[model samples]
Target: MLSEMKDHQSLMAALSENVLIVRMLLSVIFLPGASAGCGAITPVLFSTTPNFMEGLSGSCLQIPCSFNSTDPRYDITRPIYGVWLKATTAFNVTPSSVIFNSSKSVNIYQLEMIGNLTEKNCTTLFSDLNTSYTDRYFFRIESGPVRATACADPLQITVKDSPWSPSINISGGDLKEHQSVTITCSALTPCPHSPPELTWNLQQDSHRQTEKNTDGTFTTKIQENITLSDTHDGYIRCSARYPVNGGNKTAETAVTLSVSYAPRNTSASISPSGLVSAGSWVELNCSSRAKPPASFTWFWNSKHGTINVSVGQVYSFNVTEGGEFYCLATNDLGHQTSSVIRVSIKDNQVSGFTVHIILKILGIIMLYSTIILLECWFRFFKKPKMKTQEPTYVNSEMAKES
Candidate 1:
């Protein structure tokens, strides 16, 4: 019993030394494996590999991988078999999802296992990539006491169709109505075998083109010359289409077009009438047609020329005394002056047919008052005098005749 305990202690000491050596090697290279029994290190180990890979769905992709192991025997004659697999969970240390068994299965992809067991290089490649290739692929190996399902760092393969969306760029910063602008739309075609074609939903005609990059990708573009108007101020979309197996896949991008323009057909008007009256409020409104709503500036013309009085779309003032009023409409693009409108102020707060009615009513009241005065004089002093005077004249005539 004592001899067995001594042997076990020696074995533990040797494993401790191996663990320390492996921990040191971790700085330069990744040595991943399990302890062989209680006294030995893992004979087979998986080396470092990429964690992510992206590929076109209809194209081919290659993942460079390699592995290493600690063999005490240093026996190169013994066959070291390797296998590749995919993992369901990224956090799993060992996975059973099998993809290619290098020992038994036929190597359809030539580079599926370019790494020789003797050389310890385990690079892999896949042909005719599709959605099925989208997974985290891992590496496994079989040797002496080292048997692992998923021993290497898995590679996350991303298989996709064409690019997601296109980008549209407008050359002019502030565009105006009737002005022309250049619109360029671009998209990337990952699968060079069938490059995407660019197109636009423009009111005017446009030109489309495609460029092949040295990285085996294609960039599609379109140049559009648009004559902007009020009707063209809205959302515009650009689309790119790439050929697939059965049909073509399309992607779109939308952008807003804001065409700034100077004001047009600007005019000023008064609320009540062009002729104003004293103490009455007169409202002035300035209006125009513009991309962005126009701002109005009220100006009063005098001997010294036009002078700014107010700023807004609407202005109100007491018609204490009036001369002439006008407004100018303006925006980021340009400005426009409205036609002058003359406002004549009367002495009293009366205007239109209202003045005629008031004057007629006053005239009628004066006429009635004059008639009453005359009637009072006839019924009082004047009537008495006439009756008395006529009697006196008759008596005088009779006295003369006797």
Candidate 2:
């Protein structure tokens, strides 16, 4: 009986301990709020097609985004909508999605497909994107329980650098005689999808003029009817200035005009065509052909150097003097001159030279008069006297003539 009683007591103690353990396990399992679980955060992403492509006026651009929910329990029957914000605006965010969905908060953000966002894919687009939206756009995504976001690298739509040498097209053909002409500058490089501004300037004049932007790359002509002057060699240039990813960028090109009417070819020659004797007058008439008559100057190789004969272009030098000489002719266009002439005065001054020339002239005149008088006398008298007198008279007349 004692053994039986001891066994029963031990068994009762074991049963009581097992019951306590079971109760503790039940309390742990049924602890309040234990069933709720925290979900992990997952990231959403965005991308642009062509990543980069040229843009035209009134054109469209597309942006795509992919998203997934962290909590399996969260319903994604509809993906969260996304927003497009301008990077440059001071607004906390860009004017509400330049693109987004119209339906449920969880509905797919579709850019209207007409202008901006189109379908549930979170694929957004921009149409007629103007200068107002010239700034960069980024993506922002939001869902029922979770919000995630991703950004695309800034896109720089700008006019590319122009060709090394650019041709200028004038509204009318190249103008002449100080006439006015309209000239438009277009970029050889294609324009970016982004908006750009085109401008013109004359470097020499420091004149800045704006051209009408036809497209991002082309400009409407600016009429510059100038009463051009020599100084008008001023260079005309065009530039396209626009925004870039890192900052701002610019492209430029230029052209120069040879205003039509110019001075004509000119010449200068010596009358005797070579060295003029020393102390003798040397005439150098500098003559040039031009619409407006040109000016002339005489230069002498002097001790002081090539000295301009302040007098004029026709240089007169006494051949008795020694010097090197030349003549220069000029017009509004330019100037040119004759070859150098060397002059040396010889020591001997021949006084009889003039007398000799005078005597020779007088003798010739006397001889001619005598011949005429005799010819007339012979013609009238010799025929009557006889043909025999003719030979003698003819001989005398010939001698006088000689």
Candidate 3:
């Protein structure tokens, strides 16, 4: 054991170049009544308080830690310096991860250790925490030969991002029209004395309730039982307000309400409603506004038991004579047939054909006018030119001599 102590001292000396390790040795060397060989003292059995805790990002975190030893060789109430280290694993402890060494390096956190080593409390405060700070943390004591560390089962800490809205709990099912349902919204209050106020924006009759927990925290719950109707099938919101510096901070949550019902407001229409001809194109359309869009079925009225033409929103085909056409819209709840629309198929040349024939005659007249213009241009304005005779020079004088 004496040789082992010498080897430990040599290893400590070799690592003295690191400021953290040097500070750790100084913390141990400055302990009260630690004036003896380093190896003569016994190690301590250390354990932390509240083996696990949760922290929120973008906020300050406090870990209340305390430890004591089972070994009778040490006194539990004495002022023994400590070294706090953070590690990924508790089995293999290393010296490079030392966070702080009391009596030498202070102010490693936002505030100095709020714990008293003489009282066996090693609580620490970390400020402006972020997601990357999730890990296991433990403490170590290095006074004389009593150099000890606790990492086998260090404290587990998980960090979460700040929540945007309050938690909303709803209890109901199978929401039909005119149904009643209960909804509750809750928000956490860090202060017990001042509970937050809750309100629902849907203008429903709601009640507010608050509870005080044993951990000095408060919870505000707002509940409402409302008869849901067509007007209630929109965004329903709940908000919680808490007092701040001079005003208030509020958080809200919203949910869309969907109500199921049968098909309603059914109607049918023909594309060409006024006039039609035999073997002319026409379309019949059926529509309804329903929760789960209703199915459509088209029918053409005839003496032979109303022939079922098709099953869809639109039916298009050529019609022979004037007939009756309608459609049926059905859903899970109920079904309804639209009012019959009488289609008039003109067998004796409808007035629409006269307009079409007039348009055709106008087109033929324009074509003939264009042909006449071209022929007149060729006969008069576009006539071929005749060849000109060459002029005779001094022919008059030659004629007089002959």
The model with the greatest TM-score is 1
lDDT of 1 by residue, 49-96 (tens): 656667666655555566765545435566766777666543443434
Off by over 4 Å in 1: 1-130, 136-163, 171-182, 225-234, 242-249, 258-261, 273-279, 289-295, 300-309, 319-324, 331-333, 341-402
lDDT of each: 0.70, 0.49, 0.70
Range of the 10 consecutive residues with the lowest summed lDDT in candidate 1: 32-41
Report the alpha-carbon TM-score of model 2 versus the true structure.
Answer: 0.31
* Per-residue C-alpha lDDT of model 3 across residues 1-402, encoded as one tens digit per residue: 999999999898777658777776776676432332222233345655556665555554556667786556565555577776677654445756676787766445443466787777776666655677777777777655566766433767666564336677767888766678876788764432345677877555566677754432346788777776656666768776655434555678887778776777899998887878788999989999777789999988986769999989999988876678899999887788899998887855557788899999999999999999999988997787899999978789888999
Model 2 lDDT tens row, 164-257: 2333565557444465655555543232344344567643332333342332232222234455544444477776555444444566777775
- The weakest ten consecutive residues by lDDT in model 2 span 33-42
